[model samples]
Structure formats: structure tokens, C-alpha cells
Target: MNEQQENKPLISLQNVTKTYGEKTVVDDLSLDISEGEFVTILGESGCGKSTLLKIINGLITPESGSVSVNGQKIATPAPAESKLVKLRRDIGYAVQGSVLFPHLDVAQNIGFVLTLDKKSKPEIAEAVERARKIAGVEKELLTRLPGQLSGGQAQRVGIARSIAARPKLLLMDEPFGAVDEITRRSLQDELSRIVKQEALTCLFVTHDTAEALKLGSKVLILKTGKIEQYDTPEKITQQPATPYVNTLVNR
Candidate 1:
């Protein structure tokens, strides 16, 4: 880690709250993610796990609260900050569906960000090569449609596109949830390796106990719009914070 990264939080949430007309969704939730730290938010359905990632991505804004990236408080993204535009140019987000455009091919999808930055053609080609090597994207698959991809292949493309800009933090919403068991396992292992190699801070969301345990150095368990437990995955798995947490893990 560099000196700047050591001193700065890649992502910080303070007193974040989101609500509809009558119901609060996420309430006063605060968290910090340091560079290279993988933090997982684990929760049951409707527990606001996905909401937190959206807030970080700036897709959904909080009615009241603040999010700072690289020491700068960010407002909602603008058109100038297109999908290719990194919200902070430091956080990369991957969603659950990972819906790739049916019309675009793998290289085209991965090259999307480079084009937005208006990088030269040579630079885009070089970056694409690196992305493919790092993400293990096959050459032949580059021209194939999303319709032709296996679940794992599609997920790999989604992740590769997210990392093409080389963001310091990755915000993922159950990136592995849709794949089959074997593919999911493979991706998780591959992602762990990539996280270490890239030294990337990641805030990933998942409801699966084992998934959280496998990916996170620390896990935050959310229940009904509140954090019920925040600790290492082993700590949560071995030492439940409450009866509710115990039931969730044990069951």
C-alpha cells in the first residue's frame, strides 16, 4: 500500500439514511472501507443490503447522509459521468444481474470505459489486452454475443468491464449469486486472487452465509434497516452477536 492510500479511506459513509414517503430503508448507517479491504454486507432479503451498494454507486441517493470517495464528498453522478464515467474514478460497481447488452460483444463491453475517457486507440487496445489477461477472457469469446455466453463467462465479462478503468474500490451486489454452484465457486476463488493482486477495496453484498465468510475480511450483517453485527466472518460464524444472528447463521 502507498502512503496516500494508507491515510485515506477509499469509501466513507456517514449517517446515511434512505426512505420512501413513510418507511425508512437504511437508517443512519455508517461504514468505512480502506484501500484493499474487502468488506461484505450480509443480510436477508429486504434487509437493505443491495440498497447500501446502490448508495455507494450513487444510483440511489440517500435522503439524508454523505458519501465521500477519496476525501471528496460526491453528489449524484451527472451525464458527463456516463456509465463509462467512474463516479469517483476510484470505485467500480458490479450489479447482481450484470446485464450485458445483447448487442455488444466482450471486447466492446470491456472497451466501453476507455472510449468514454477518450483514450487513444492504441491505449484502448493495450488496456483491453491487460483486462483480458487479468480477467481470463478468451480471445474467441471477445466477438460472441451475450446470448452465447455461459453464466460464468458472462459474469467474467461483467467483472472485467468493471475493472477496466482500474478503480481502487469495487462495489458489487451479489455478483456471484446468479451462477451455478460450480461456476460460482470458481469465480469466488478467482475474485479472491484478483482482489489480492489488484489490492482493491471491495464492498460486496450477499445473503449467503458462506459467501460472506469466504470473501470478506469483515462482515456487516444487516437486519431490518440496521446493522446487527459487524465483525470478521469467522467471528460472526463462530460467535453470533444475537439470537437473530445465531438463527440466521445456524439455520
Candidate 2:
């Protein structure tokens, strides 16, 4: 309890629920995520972790309840003005199999968001270059089309592009899914370093327990639309809340 009180939560979900037809993917779900924290939502294929992320980002609306960020009540599909606009500007979302413009290369993809922000040409160029540097994107790769880039390279491009917006919260769904094991490990380490250095508040969703344990400061096991367990990675492993959680970690 004392340990839980340490970080100041930046987002809180209260009595959040979502339903599709007869199925309840997330039911009366609630959570609190601290500022500058990395919280991973782990579950099986049909669980609502991914959907929850979309809801938080206002890509999807909940059937009931509220999602608040930094004490402001977030309207569903948030208004595209002022703080909401700025909040949208500050939150980054990344996904596996993320679509990249076939016509665009690394530099172009990273520059797209900057262009939308009405930044100066030099500012856009500088941001694009910095993002590329942070993602370890090669100068040569910047010239190559997305089709020419490998899976790992494409993923890095996606990461660089997402961060270029300077989002305060990052929502990632299986961002390492397409990469090979070696590249996945390298990317994971790099991401952890980047998130820590930037004081990013991140919500990552993965079906893999290893991935959850490796990346999450807090790991929440969601069963359908509900959180079955929420704890530190070590605590979740050492003292699972249910037989299913133990089985998952053990497996």
C-alpha cells in the first residue's frame, strides 16, 4: 500500500465499461496510472486491454464511466480544441503492423507530424533529424522507401514518427511483434531507456508475460474487461492474484 502511493498518477479511469453485442470486453474497469510510469496491460487474445487503450486515447468511446487525465475530465472522443487538442498532440500511439506510407521514406514519415504542427521548415528538419537519431535510424535508410526497409527498421521508423509529436503519454500495442528476437530485445532496451529518459507515461499492451514483465513498472492482468490483478512485475510474479495469473507467468 505504501509502495503504491509513491508515484502521482496522471490518469485515472473510474467505472469504465465497454460492451459489443452480448459480449462485455471490459466491464466496470478502473485504473490509475502514475505520471512518468510504464504500466503494461497483459492478457489473453480476447481480453479488452487493447480496446481500453483506444478508449483512453478517445479513438473509441466507452459505454459508461469516465477517464480523467491530470484532473481534467476527458470528454469522449475529446473535443479537438485547446487543451484537448494539445493533449492529443501530447499523446503518442503506436501499434504493430502499423501502416507506413508506401510512398514515403524514414525522413518523410517523421516529418509528417511536424508539418501538421505548422512548425518552421528548419524546426521540422531538426525534429526529424533528432527523432531519427533517437531511433538509431540510418541516414541511408532515410532515403529508402518503406518497402525497402526490413521489419525491424520499419518498426523503428514507426517509433521515431510517434515520438516526433512530443506526446506526453505513449500507448503501444505489441510494438515489437513483427521484429525478430534479437532485434526485439535491442528495441526493448532502447525503448526502456528512451521512456525513462523522457519521463514518459506509457501504457503498453501485450499478450506475452515476458514482454509485460520486462517493460512494466506496473503490470495489470485483465480478464475480459476487468483487471484481475494489478501490481509491480515482481509482485505479480511472486504473488499472483489468481491461479490463471500464476499459470500465465509460469507458462
Candidate 3:
């Protein structure tokens, strides 16, 4: 581990396992993510990529093992409500598709969390402005409702909402998958710039190998609920750990 990595982990999972009925979704998973690292989880469909993200963010509980984020121990089966609420407030999650509230306009959607917390109007406005800049949301779009916008635009708004709270960590699961190739590239560029500028610790999940390679400081490959490789993108590209990973990179 480098000096930065040695600075204590921001997210740690030890022997974590999640099962739905008879199928194990995550099998004895253990990982450590350093502060400010952009880690991408890359795997095939149903490989538990999304499930891992959910566990980190307290959306789902593992059947066994432990998860700790920002020094707070997360309880599996059922996380403590107060602690989970506070943790959720400090983490931003952006999933695929437009998750904007159908009734609210872009600005309202972006500032929804702050509004729920009853923040001052000025504070909410300031946060919305910063989020808009980061997400490339235009001023004109702020007044437009979700149904009025294109897929890319709606996704931009969704991202804006997720980051408006200025959370310590961001978890994204295929957030750009629904857009066209050109729009997806544009969103990726925008997101890359924004996350770097903000110095955010992020865990991004994607099935697209190129996207994973392009965005990750470190890439984690999973197969059958087990880790295949966890290394820098360059290393993963140059020296894949398994036949599946080699073929994945080659293609």
C-alpha cells in the first residue's frame, strides 16, 4: 500500500456475505477503500455489483460479516436507524435511469434533500447552483420538470440532486447507461471533472469495461460473487488475473 492508502480506510468490508434464498450474492467479500479514491466495480450482470453498492450505502443488509464507512460500524441484518440515517445523509447514491421526482422541477429536485432538512433558502440555492455547475445543468432547465427533459438532461438533474448535499462519498451504479453513446461520453467527462475537482471518494459500478478503465483509480473485478482482481486500471489492463478478466479486457 502507498502512503495515501496507508492513511486508514474510508470504507471497509470484512468477510461480508449476502444471500437471497439459496443463491449467495456476495461471498465472503472483504475490501478497503481509501479516502478520495475513485474505485470502480466492474463485473458481468448479476455478479453482485449493485448489491455491494447498496450494502455500503445502508440500503441493504448482508446476511453475515461487517461493513464500516467513515469509521462507523455498519450493522448487518438491520443497521441502527439513527446511525443509518446520519450515514445516508453523508453519502450520495446515483443509480441508473432518471430518478427525479415527477412533480418537481430540476432545481427543486436538486435541492430536495436540503429542503427536507429545512435548510435556509439561500443555502439550498447555493448548493443547487454548485450542483448545477457540476452536473452541467443549464439555468433554463431548472424550471423544467422531469417529463419535459431528455434522458441525458434528466440524468444530469439526477446527478445534480445526488451531489447537492456535498456528501463524503458517492456511489454510482450505471448512472449513464440509459443515455446515447455521445451523451454517455459527455456525462462521463463531466462527472470525471466534477468528482476530481471536488476530491470525492467514489465507488462506481459499471458493466462497460472501457468506462471502468477510463474512470477508475482502481478497478475491482467480480465473478460469481467473488473478487477476481483488485488493482489499478493500468495493471488490470496489462495483467488480468483470470481468463475471464483477460477476455473482458481484450474485448
On TM-score, the leading prediction is 3
Q: How many clashes (backbone N, Cα, C below 3 Å) per candidate?
A: 0, 4, 0
What are the models' TM-scores? 0.89, 0.91, 0.94
lDDT: worst 10-residue window of model 3: 89-98
Q: Kindly report which residue stretches of model 1 are placed more than 4 angstroms away from their true locations once superposed.
A: 1-8, 75-87, 90-97
In order, candidate lDDTs are 0.80, 0.82, 0.87
Query: Candidate 3, residues 1-251: lDDT per residue as tens digits?
Result: 78865689989999999999999999999999988899999999999999998888887899899998877877565768776776676554433335789999989999998897799999999999999998889999999989999988998898889888887788898888889999999888888887898888888999999999999999999987899999999999899999999999876
lDDT of candidate 2 over 1-251, digit per residue (tens): 47655565678898988899999988998888888889998999989888988887766678888888776677554555576656676555333336678998778887887887899999988988888888788888888889999988898888888777666788888788877999999888888987887677888889989999999999989997888899999999999899989999976
Which regions of candidate 2 deviate over 4 angstroms? 1-7, 76-86, 90-97
**Model 2 whole-model lDDT (C-alpha atoms):** 0.82
Which digits, one per residue and each the tens of the lDDT, describe model 1 over residues 1-251?
Answer: 67875867777888888887888889998877777788889989999988888777767778777887667666433224464245555445444347887898888888777887799999988888787878888889899998999999998888888778777777788888788999999899888888889888888899998888888988899997888998887888789999888987777
Clashes of 2: 4
Q: Would you list the rank order by TM-score, best first?
A: 3, 2, 1
The weakest ten consecutive residues by lDDT in model 2 span 89-98
| Winner on lDDT (2 vs 3) | 3
